[model samples]
Target: MKQGGDLLSLVGYQLQQANLRLETDARAVLADFDLTPAKLTALILIRDNPGCDQTTLGRALSINRSSAMKLVNILVEKRLIERQPGRDLRTNALVLLPEGQRQVDAMLAAVHRSDTRMTARLSREDIQTLHNLLTRLGPATGAAED
Candidate 1:
């Protein structure tokens, strides 16, 4: 391929666009609730991985521990997440608040609409193939576990 070919044709470019769309749609979708993307992401992470602690959550989200803690702190301040002392007593395990769960459900609906619009031209298999290709280019879920 020629250097710096039109970005749209590049998978990286498409994924970047997809991510931007997700963020933009999500911010608007979440605006009334006054939630930021980072806060919403932490809520979703806790919802999907109920027993997750800061260290693990940070790694999963590809953020550092301090940043993750700051995000978690905001969620806690907003009462969107409940942080309980971990069994280790030195860490905090997170769970989504009821309101947070509702937010995630609503966000999922919005994100689904955005995804459908983004990939309207692709077949189900094409979507799966794209997922596989992206995974091949980066460390996937289990690979991120320390």
Candidate 2:
């Protein structure tokens, strides 16, 4: 197969291409649940971290305050999450509702299946090596694992 010259040799370009393909698969999986990647991620985070606030969730998701608020509001409207009084009066603690938990559980499995399908061409060792290399390329901050 013909490669795209020097661009094909660039790690960033390769990673972007891979990410786009993965995201496309993810979107297809998410579409069944009427969810987006961001929304599903937010629900998972809320489920994992009980009583987490919007600001904290936003930081973890690398989004700003306003965007976080909008996301939270949509979740609230969808009845997928609820905002309760936080430790501080200024912030609202986020929690996944039962429906949200159910959706997340189902979506998680679907996404995993999608990923498995995508990586079917790779051997176990190849997958592990790819994961390790990607991890190494991630930011040095421990938060990168999240």
lDDT by residue for model 2 over 36-68, one digit each (tens)? 988899999999999999999999899999999
What lDDT does the true structure give each of the candidates?
0.80, 0.92
Candidate 1 per-residue lDDT over residues 28-136, each given as its tens digit = 7668678776666777889988978989999878899899888888888888788887869788888888987887888777767767876789999999998888777
How far out, in Å, is residue 57 in model 2?
A: 0.8
Query: How far off is residue 73 in model 2, in Å?
Result: 1.1
